[model samples]
Target: MTRSDLNNWLIDLSEINSIYIFSGSEGLWFLISVVAFVWFILAIYRVEKNDHTSIEEELSNPEDLKNLIIEINSDEVDKNNSN
Candidate 1:
């Protein structure tokens, strides 16, 4: 189908009536509502916690990590002031 034909089909579908709510058993409705509420809360939390950090920040923050044996050996040699 062409782009114009698909666009016309979508426009025709937009005229149909759609009820967003379902009037079913109380237990089913409650379960669906609870799930939807939890999902919305989690989405909000992730958005708040997401931050962009630069690569420089990550590379410079390795002091908390223990250095390897080679680093320790180099430090000892430097302390002794050997060639």
Candidate 2:
């Protein structure tokens, strides 16, 4: 069949909705972007809907949590010598 006939047979102009399939690395990127978008939306939804511990109740100790703890004199340093 000719190119014109093939085109006409493949795509119908009367259809209200058209679906296209993407291929190759460009398609991979599109898929990745869609996943990332969904992930971000889910994260936002969870944050807004989930209940979390309050700041005052959560952080009672200054150096308790691994991530929140600060480096406080691991080695014995001269605290008396101010010079």
The candidate maximizing lDDT is 1
Tell me the tens digit of each residue's lDDT in model 2 across 1-83. Answer: 33222345466656624334332356688899999999999998787655454553576665555445433342224454543
Candidate 1: list runs displaced more than 4 Å.
1-24, 51-83
Model 1 C-alpha RMSD vs. true structure (Å) is 14.3
Candidate 1 Cα deviation (angstroms), residue 75: 48
Worst window of 10 by summed lDDT in candidate 2? 69-78
* lDDT (tens digit, per residue) of candidate 1 on 1-83: 33222334345676645424342355788898999999999998776656323434544646633354468788999989975
lDDT of each: 0.61, 0.57
- Output the TM-score of candidate 2: 0.32
lDDT of 1: 0.61
Q: Count the backbone clashes (under 3 Å) in each candidate.
A: 0, 0
User: TM-scores across all candidates?
Assistant: 0.32, 0.32
